[model samples]
Target: MNRLPRPERFILVDDNEADNVFHEIMIRRAGFTGDVLIFDNGLDALAFMRQDELRVPTCIFLDINMPMLDGFEVAIQAAPLLEGRETTVLVMLTSSGSPQDRERAAQIPVISGYVTKPLAAALVRDMMSA
Candidate 1:
């Protein structure tokens, strides 16, 4: 049994439902014992984030492309909400291979890593350790 947190809180921002399930499974199998919060759109995620009552996750797996407020915009908005809180790891979880996307993700101070879609256990482990 995983002796870690019963439900390792994670924010998964993918538009695809299957992708959500896959990552959720991968995360748990990776030894993360937390609830994976799924959001299809960055604006929806951002809306929840604006709520002071919203709980920040241990990490965020953000999708670069989404309707209404893409990952870049979400990152911009999420920064202030995360102020005064501990480092909540943010990583780009997307299929986007654009050099510009990488550059943009790098520019976001809150974003710790840029991960490709279909998050694997190894990537999860690396992020957890980082």
Candidate 2:
């Protein structure tokens, strides 16, 4: 089992405030010491990504639903931008179980995986190990 080095970065995108808070808490409780960036919408996250100094998160947890630039649209826009940086991984975290939702996520090259809502410690462990 190859574990990732310490100080891993994570970016979580979700419209719901409560979900974001819970996710953050879980990540911290897991003993993963790193910056957990939160974005309420995709546009803000994308904007931050454009900044030269913005640390590229090790993994991005994006929600399928959002106001002003949804998950799919964000992926479509941000994928190319992050391509030049090879270390980052994008995962769609959504409550959606629809095949169409998963299919849409699959279309984006930047998106590495799709996860259901309420991110668990196991999910964090697996993603960080990747």
Q: Please give the lDDT score for candidate 1.
A: 0.75
Query: What's the CA error at residue 66 for candidate 2, in Å?
Result: 0.3
Q: Which digits, one per residue and each the tens of the lDDT, describe model 2 over residues 1-130?
A: 2123332788889999999999999888777788899999999999987774534446778998999989999988997677755557778889999999998888777787888888898767665655
In model 1, the clashing pairs are: 7-33, 7-34, 8-33, 8-34
TM-scores of the models, in the order given: 0.83, 0.88
Per-residue lDDT tens digits of candidate 1, residues 1-130? 1112222478888788899999999998888876778888887887877763444345778888887778888888898876555635567888988899999888887776787777899767756664
Task: State candidate 1's TM-score.
Answer: 0.83
Candidate lDDT (C-alpha), each: 0.75, 0.80
- Relative to the true structure, candidate 2 reaches a TM of 0.88
Alpha-carbon RMSD to native, per candidate: 4.4, 2.8
Predicted structure 2: clash tally: 0
Worst 10 residues of 2 by lDDT: 1-10
